[model samples]
Target: MLKQIANLDQNSGNTFKLLTDETGCCGDSITPCKYVAAVPVANSVSAVVVKDRDGNNQTVTFAAAATTVKAIRDALVTAVNSVGYEDDGNVLPGISVETVSTNKVVTIVGELIVVSLTTSGGSVAATATCTEVGICEFYVEWGGGASKVLTVNGVNATLGDLTFATASAANVKSALEGAANWPSGAVATVVKNTDDSIFEITVTNAQSTVAFILDGLRLTRSNCIVDYV
Candidate 1:
C-alpha cells in the first residue's frame, strides 16, 4: 500500500515531504510481492535580511529546495557590500578582542612607604610601618591608550612615587594562575601556588590586540598584571 507521511519543517527553514509506498516484484501476473520504501523531497525556502554598514537593510531570497551554504554566503557578501562605513570606501575596522594576564606590583628594595589607593572595590591605606599589605582592589581598564586615574591614600606623594605593584618571585610565577583585575578586554582568574603564598593571574580575551590595566594598592596588585594582547 502506498501512503503519504508527515511533512517536516527544519529549524534551518527547510521543508521536507515524506512518502511511503510498497514495492511490487515481477510476478504481478499471479501475486505481487511487496517491500516497504520511503522517499523524501525538499520543498522549503528561506531568505536572509542583513544590515549594511551604511545602516541600510538588504534582503536575499533563496528558492525552494535550492538554498546552498555557498549561495547564502554569497548573498551575505552582497548584502554587506550594499553599505559603506563612514561614506569612505574603506571598510570600518572590526572590533578588537583579546585576553591578557599580567602581574603588577610595587617593590620596596628597602624602607616601606605610606600610601593611599582606590579601586573598584574600595580604598586601602598602606603605612610605612608595615612590610606588606593584602591585595584588595583589582583595576580593569579597557581600550588601548586610555588613561585612568586611581586615587591612592597617602600622607604626601608625587607622581614619581606612583608605581605599579611588584610581585615576589613566587607571585610573579603564579600570577597568571589566579584571578586578578580583569577589564573589559578579557576575563580573568587568579590561582594560588601550591604553597598558597604565591598567585598567578590568568586572563582570556575573546578578541586579539586588547589590553587591560590594573591599578591599586600593594595588596590590590599583589598577584595581578596588565594584560596586553
Candidate 2:
C-alpha cells in the first residue's frame, strides 16, 4: 500500500506549485479566490479546559449560543493569559497564544495541553483538545506518485496518527509549519473556497514537487484537498 510520501522519495530538486481553478497556470498565477469553506464558528455554547506544561488548569467558558468562532478564540486566549483575574490562575504563563489562518487555530507557545472541553449554558458541545507532542508525521507526494514519510518532532511519533479538528485547518498548517523536516523555503497554507465546504492545502516552494498526506488522505495535484471533519 502507499505510505507517507516521504518514504517513497527524497526532496530531490523538484519545485512545488499551486494550481488555479480558473487559470491552468501553476504558481505565479492569479486565480479568482472563492470560499471553499466558511470559518467554523461555535455551533453550540461550550467551555474548554487548558492544562499547561506546568499542570496549571485554566477554564474558559463560552455562553454565546451562536457566536463567531473568532470571538470564542479571543475570549479563550484572553482568559488563559489574564493574571489575578479570577480564581482560575493563568493556565499558560509565559506561553504566548499565537493564532494562525485568520484565528482558526490557536497555539499556546512553549506547549500547553488541552485537558478537557465542555460546552454548556446555551448548548453543550465537546471541548477543544490539543494532543500536540511537538511532533508531526506527513506523507508528501509529487509527480508520478513519488512520495516520502517525513517525520518531525522531539521523538518518534506514530506515522499518520496525528489528528485535529477539521473546522480548524490551521491546526494542520501549524503542525506542518512547526515541524523541522519540511524543506527550507517550502511552506504550507490552507485556503477555503466560498462555493463549497472544502479546505485545500497548498505547499509552495521555489523547488520541490510537494504534496502531502494526513489522516489517510493524499494531498497531491489531483487531490490536495480537505473538508470538515
Candidate 3:
C-alpha cells in the first residue's frame, strides 16, 4: 500500500504497506465484515480459535472467573496481539484486535477470522471474509542518482531492492520477475508502460487483495518511489 506522501490524515492513505497473503480476503460476502466477531461469553472455561498469519489455529484461554466486559476485552486484545507481536516476537503476522465504545458498551472491533467460541449455553462465532483476487501490482518511479539503491519492503535488489542508476522498463521487469520477491505467490508478468521507465509491475496470486503489512515501516529509499492508487 503505497499511499500519499503529504496528506492531512496520516492513516487515511499516507502509509507504506506490504503484502502478506496474496489469496487473503478483501471484505467480500464469503467472509464476514471486520469487527463482526461475537462478543465472548465466559463459561467453565472460555476460548476463541483464530487463524494466525500462517493459517495456523491459535487458541487463547481465559479463566472462568474473568467475567467483566473490560476483563474480556482486555484479555482478548492482549491475547490476540500477543500471539503476533509478543509471543512470536513479531516473527508471525498477528490478528489486529481493536475496541469501540458507545455510552458504556464496548464492542470488539477488528478483522479477525474467528473459528469458534464456547459459552455456558452453547457456542457463538464470527465468520471471516475474503475477496476473490489473483493479481498484485506495483507502481514505481525511481528518482535519478548514481548507484541508486531502492529498498521496497526488505529485498534490496531489482524491483524491490534494486540498485540502479537509470534503467529502462525492461530492466525493472527482469529484476522484479527474476527475483520473485512478491507477497507469498509467484510473479506472472512485468509490463513496461509508455513512459518506458517501469510504470507498473503486476503479480498474480490466488488470494484476493494480498493482505498483510511488511515487518516494519522502515524503507531504505534512495531512489524508489511508490505511487498510491
Candidate 4:
C-alpha cells in the first residue's frame, strides 16, 4: 500500500516530498510537485503504478484511446484519480492528482509517483482519439471461479443459487435487478463472452440512464473495477 497520505505509520516520520523540476533531486523546494510528463502517439496508452500503505500495489490505466493532446491529458487526470476508486470494501490506501494543464501539457504530482507513458512523455500524438470500451458497462459471468453473493436492497442471497449457466436472459435480469433488494437496484449484461463463459458474475452497467448506488450490493473481490454503482 504505497499511498501518498503519509503518516499512517507514525514511525515513518514526515515522509512527504513536493515535486521539483526533473533536473533537481528529491527533498528540494521545487516549482512543481513530483510528477511525470509525456506526449503520447496516436493510439497510445498509459498507466500509473501506485502502492498502498500496507505495501499493496495497484495499476491504473488509461486504455489506448486518447488521440489528442488535451484528451490524453484529461484521460491521464481521470486515470490517476482512479487510483483507489473501487475496492472500498478493503479500504485500501489513497492518493490525489492536481496540476495546471496548459497547451495540452499535463503534469501528475505526488510524493512517490511512478508513471509510464506511450510515445513520448512530453511528446505525444496529435492528442488522442478512441472509443472507451469500459466505464459504466459491466458484464456478469455465469462461471469461472467467481463465488459472488449479493445484498439486494437489504437481503443477502447467493447469486449462483438463483441463476445457473443455462438460465434465460430474462431470468438473469430478474435475478440481478429485480432482486429482493429493490431499495438499491443492481444492473448487468448477460451476454456470452467469446468462449461463451460467465467468469464475471455481475458488473456496474450502462444499459440504462437511470443509475443508482446499488445500496446493499457489493463485490468483495472485484469491487475496485468501478467507482459508481
Candidate 5:
C-alpha cells in the first residue's frame, strides 16, 4: 500500500538549480524532482602585428580581418620614405626612382671616358737628325662597328711615318699642345712608366672607334682597339 507524488521549481536566472530524490514518503509512497542545467556562449576576436625591415620588432598592430594587403603596402612605403635613403640625407643629386607598373627601377645618367691609350709617344727626327720636337696632330678612328673620328690637335704635323723629316721630341710635344682643331671629347695626357715613355689619349666612347689614323709628315694607322663586345 504505497503512494507517489512529484514537484518542480523554476529559477529567475539563465541557469537552473537541480534537485532529485527517489524515496517513499509513506509506507510505500515516493516523490521525484528534476532541474535543468545552463551553458555559456563566448565570442572571439582576431588581430595582427606589423614589423620593420630589420625584423627587430613590430611598429604597429592591426585588427586581423580589418587590414588589407594594399593598406599594408602603403604603410611600408611611407615608412621607407620617412626613414630616407640609406638612413642618410646626403644622397647624390640627379638620381631618381621610377616605377613601371609592378616593376620599380632606378636610373642614373652620367658621363665617363671608356676608351684609353696605353702607348702613344715615339721618337721622330728631322733631316735624319734628332731634333727636339713635339707631336703636332693626332687623329683617332673608330675600329668597332660604329664610324667615328677624333682629332687631338689642330696644327698640321706628321705621325708614325719616318719617311719625312723625323720630328724631334720638342716638335711632337708642341703639336699636342698647339693643335687648333683638337676635339674636346677626350683628354690627352703624358704618362711615363718605369720601363718606357708614352702618351695616353682617353676616348669618351670605347666602342665608337676602331683605330687611330695619325696624319702629319707621314700617314700611319695603328690598331688601338682595346675592348669590343
Candidate 6:
C-alpha cells in the first residue's frame, strides 16, 4: 500500500508524520519512524549482465573511473533502457527503472540473473527468505491503503499480514510459527515494532537448497516509482 510520513508545518499546524493507523497505534506503531528510499551504498561493479525472461541479454557496463554509487546506478539504468534490450516484438513485463534517494532501483517481476560479476561487484542478490522450489503470490498492505500483490518463491516462507484492531502482528506470527510441516522446512518468525504498525516475516532456520525468486520488492504506485513506504 502507498504510505506517507509527513512533517507538520509549524505555521499551518497540521497533523504530521509519526503516523498512526485507524487502530490508534501512533508513532509507537510498527511503522518506521522515517522511511527513505534506498540508495546504493558503497560498493563497485565492473559490469552487470542481466538476462531477460526471453533470454535476451543486456550488459550494463560501469566505466573503470565510475566508482561512485550514483555513477554505477546511472549506467545500469541507461544500459537496461537502451534500444534493443528487449527481444523483438516482446515487452519486459512488470519491470521498472526508477531513481530512489538518488540511487537506481529496478523492480523486476520475472526471472533475472547476473550471468557474470567482477570483484568490484557488491553483494546484490534476492532478499526473499525462501528455501524451497514453488511460487506463492499474496497481497500485503502497510497502514490503511490498497494492498500490493507480490509473488514470492518457496524460499521466502516469511510474509507479513496486518490487522488494525484486536488482531496484532504477534498473533499472526504465533500462528505461522506454530504451523505444521512447513514446506520450506524452516520455522518462521514474525516481528513487529513496539507500536505494532509494521511487521516482518522471516525464517528461523535459513536453507538454500532451492533458489528463491521474488516478483518485486517494492509495490507499483504513481509515476512508475515503486513505493517503499
RMSD of each: 28.0, 21.6, 18.6, 15.0, 37.7, 19.3
TM-score of each: 0.23, 0.27, 0.30, 0.27, 0.20, 0.30
Better of 4 and 6 by lDDT: 4
Ordered by lDDT, highest first, the candidates read 4, 3, 6, 2, 1, 5
**The best candidate in terms of lDDT:** 4
lDDT of 1 at 197: 44
State how far residue 180 of model 1 sits from its true place (Å). 13
Determine which window of 10 residues in candidate 5 has minimal summed lDDT: 110-119
lDDT of 6 at 112: 31
For model 6, what is the error of residue 205's alpha carbon versus the real structure, in angstroms, after optimal superposition?
18
lDDT of 3 by residue, 29-139 (tens): 123223234443333226666666457877777544234555555565555544432222221122333333421122232334556554454455654433323344433
> Looking at model 6, which ten-residue stretch has the lowest summed lDDT?
220-229
How far is 103's C-alpha from truth in model 4 (Å)? 12
Off by over 4 Å in 4: 1-32, 40-43, 55-57, 84-106, 118-229
| Tens-digit lDDT string for candidate 6 (172-228) | 555444433243444444555447565454543323322222224432112122122
Model 2, residue 63: what's the lDDT? 49
Select the stronger candidate by lDDT from 5 and 6. Answer: 6
lDDT against true structure, model 3:
0.39
Task: Give the C-alpha lDDT of model 1.
Answer: 0.27
Off by over 4 Å in 2: 1-42, 52-58, 62-66, 83-109, 120-229
lDDT of each: 0.27, 0.37, 0.39, 0.40, 0.26, 0.37
lDDT of 5 by residue, 1-229 (tens): 0011122223323142221123434542212111111111111111212223343433332223112334433432343223221111122221223344542222211111001111112111111111211222333321111112223333333333212134333434344444454443333443322243333333333223223334322223233322212
